[model samples]
Target: MFTEARLYSPVTRTGDGDVTVHLSEEHPGVRDPEYRARRNAIAALALEYVPGAALPRIDYTEDEQRVWRTVSVELARKHRRYACTDILDAAARLALPTARIPQLDEVSAALAPLTGFRYVPAAGLVPLREFFGSFAERTFHSTQYIRHHSAPLYTPEPDAVHEIVGHATQLACPRFAAVYETAGAAVARLRTDAALKFLADVFWFSMEFGVVRERGEIRCYGAGLLSSYGEIEEFRGAELRPLDVRAMGTATYDITHYQPVLYCAESVTHLEDVVGEFFATIDDETPARMRARPVSPRPAAAARPRGSA
Candidate 1:
């Protein structure tokens, strides 16, 4: 299936069970033997985390640790200036170390006590159904690999930086975790593909790219904005629309670039209320209803991918 996920994530499995996630040709690691070996080793470990087993472990190289530390420090600075209070607070509580790559078990341990969410390793491209549906059980499927070393601050794919620092930080919050749980429950009730796709769109806009108005300033809570060192600074430039679930479900935008359109909640509490209500009440008919109505004018896009995260 040529879905939006494939646009950002490397395909994980082959029919015989062997799997690999490759670096893009432009990635400097594509030509570095040691970096290639490291990626392959991590991919193998991720594949071991299928069921009834502990999450796989990785002994991160000094170079990978450097990448983690670099992003940690740089992203933290951006987060303070641009992140929403709730997200900042949760990250403080998690206290994810900045010196080394934290293991999946470590992240799961930290997140569970706070939000009942735990990290599970992923080879790559977790099925969208499994990805979103796991939220009901408070599970997060996460990739363990670091991005290619040459571009420590950049990757066109979701690395551990995006999974842990980006999504995990937000998932640790009770309110944000509740919304994800509700979303999973809603997915459980949806019987049609249209409904699921619509739900994904809503989630992408809100959970992955959402913002909030706080103290007369636009603040970011979405993981996509919180993790990217470059884009986090530029999000304020995007056109901000008030939280509108219908428009969110049908809104159009490019996934390959920084999202030029974002939905804003009045506040963090407002975020939970509006998104939570839609999740609680949405059914099979919800997508059809939203699709039947015209979304306010925007450039054409049919699918909304959670780019690199």
Candidate 2:
């Protein structure tokens, strides 16, 4: 249910190779004809793509570039205060441009030497299996369109900012890349939908919105948090539990709002160890087995009622 807002988007391709990106009524770009046309044009590039061919370069307009610049400068500030050392180091190495949105090819080029990861285009929502499974090949599916310029700091879906500024920076680190590959390999082995969903939920908790403690402060490593100017400012105040696979897989969250409950790792090493082992060992029966047992009781502090201040 949480992914309805965070992951899913309406994209339909016609038999004649035309692609239409259906924006939600509430979407910032929904009422703008120019933005809608721009989305359709960008989506067409992905539909016409040939594997191993050069990625289509988007000529982002001045307004789009301004949105990218605004979000980049603001997020950089939040990242310095809230992001974990692992991601901070990787971002520094990637050195993404702040004045303009980087093309997928540029991102892929920057990543080739660091971790052998590269980017591929996605018109819209990539199927769960194909999206995660591509990690094994060290390829990431990225959307090329920027969010509507009207809301530079907000987006209801994963745009280029989320794909590149959020994920590409993390992929610059080998440890994160290895974990992603391990998860992709695990997805390939999972048979039942329940098992696949279980792994996805665990990933949602870890790579998408997970946090860890370092030097006595809770730091965010999750891309969802790192890319959000508002969410990054508030995540440290959420209910934080120690890392637990069962808890993570079974937890309920709403992506339309700030997450109320979050899991924490003792450190980056702890996060990698627990998440990596889970991906490495999880199978079709893993979810059933984990769900059969009860999650441990929540700590008193974590059980306190959560809400915006």
Candidate 3:
């Protein structure tokens, strides 16, 4: 359930417009079979909008808005403890004038000055290659949908909570944004599917669920970890290691539970340096045949489940 302070009313748009939906914990049930089916359908549609593909505009009802807000607030509350003050400060600075769902055109206009990226309305899940490809081109593919308030913690394939609030605000920061671009290009240049998979795993661990040491304290920077209320305590007390690219092949990580271990970078520049080195190493190799092979759509088989129980 969501707190009243976090529950927001849905805003509507007409004539092929997009809106953010905030869900209430009690209303707009999350267990409805129809809702799940619709979401799955959307996920399928999202997959179709892979690299070089454009997504179609979509509409949302008031119910959807409530769901989005519920999840967004839950994520914000959960990660508040581990959040980087600097990143949060930047987010606060870039906060929209209103709490209403942002129109795609409006989002694009706001981000135009900072980066060439534009918000593309999507409904389905995107493949990893396409996902990284979007970042490589500075085009951030975002979903126009929101989760139900009743299921604030539920994972909706690609919801607005994860894309907009979790990642977009960070994208507005120059250093962070550059990391995304550089990482994307490296993924593209890697000549083997296995290498790409290894890199993706590194990204999954660090970017999506990573933590960092700041001023003698560990803080959350990975959006996936920062957006979940359940993860804050786990990550803070979890074992952390310095990121080692050479050891990535033998490295294993927890993906299901709140991460119990994390890899740290002394600084953003160090993180960037490591990625640059990995990219250079891969580029020096004889282009592997696997490079042209498509990445798997399913989650990595070796990915450690949550909790490791």
Candidate 4:
């Protein structure tokens, strides 16, 4: 029930060569014609992209830049409190622009020296294999569109903010970038849909939404939480379970709301041992082999974090 597809809206091309981003009824931009036009225009840039060409650039509007500025400033403040040292240090080194929306090329330029990772445009949902597989080549498929200007802190799907702010920062970290590349290699090794889904499931929990303990506090490294204005503040309150690859891969979660539960690594070292090792050795048979074993009982909640339960 929890396919990664649910996290994105569909983009389609018309016979007339126009692009349309089909927004759900609940999307904040669904009723705004101007916002819909913006989405379609940006999606067009991605659709028209050619491999090895320079990444598309969006001359973001004044309002769009304001949203980026507001969220970036706010998220930066929260990052100091909730982000892990790995992310914090890497972010300092990357130093993404806080006053405006940086283009994909700019992000790639900054990351080129640090992690050798570059950004490619995505119209919307990238096929799981292609999306994950790109990482093996040190390339990341990214969306260039900012979220609806009305909701500076909320988006129903991944936007440039989430891609650049959330993932680009992670990609800047050498350790985190290595894991991403390894996960891409794991994707290349898998031959079955189930195995691919299993890999994606694990990715969702670890790379996208995982947490780690640092300085006696539960800090976030996952892009999903790191880019989010609200989720970052609320993740520590979720039911904290120990990091277990099988558990994370098999677990089902809702994407429409704040996550009610999250897995925690005892430390960054613990994260590398369990999560990093899992990605490095995973194969097509790994999913069934691990799933066939009896599912372990969920570990009890981790020790209450320093600030709140």
lDDT scores in order:
0.83, 0.86, 0.57, 0.88
The runs of at least 3 residues in candidate 3 whose Cα sits more than 4 Å from the true structure, single-residue gaps closed, are 1-31, 40-57, 74-80, 96-98, 156-158, 248-250, 276-281, 284-309
Per-residue alpha-carbon lDDT of candidate 2 for residues 46-105, written as tens digits (9 for 90 to 100):
877899898999999999999999999999998999888999999999999998899999
* Candidate 1 lDDT score relative to the true structure: 0.83
Candidate number that wins on lDDT, 1 or 2 = 2
- Using all chains and alpha carbons, the TM-scores for the candidates as numbered come to 0.92, 0.94, 0.71, 0.95
TM-score of candidate 2 versus the correct structure, residues matched by position: 0.94
Between candidates 1 and 4, name the one with more favorable TM-score: 4
| Tens digit per residue, CA lDDT, model 3, 1-309 | 101122223333336543323334443444476665555454445534554454544465666666655555655565465677656765665564334556555666666777656777554334556766677778776766566545656552335666776677667666667767776787677656666666666666666666666778888777666555455546766666676654432345544345555677776667667754564455424234324444433233322334211
lDDT of 1 by residue, 59-178 (tens): 888889999999999999988999988999999999999999999999999998899899898877776678888889988888888887678888777789999999999998999999
Clashing pairs in 2: none
Query: Could you report the Cα RMSD, in angstroms, for every candidate shown?
Result: 3.0, 2.8, 9.4, 3.5
Number of colliding residue pairs in each model: 0, 0, 19, 0
Stronger candidate by TM-score (2 vs 4): 4
lDDT of 4 by residue, 195-217 (tens): 88888888888898899988889
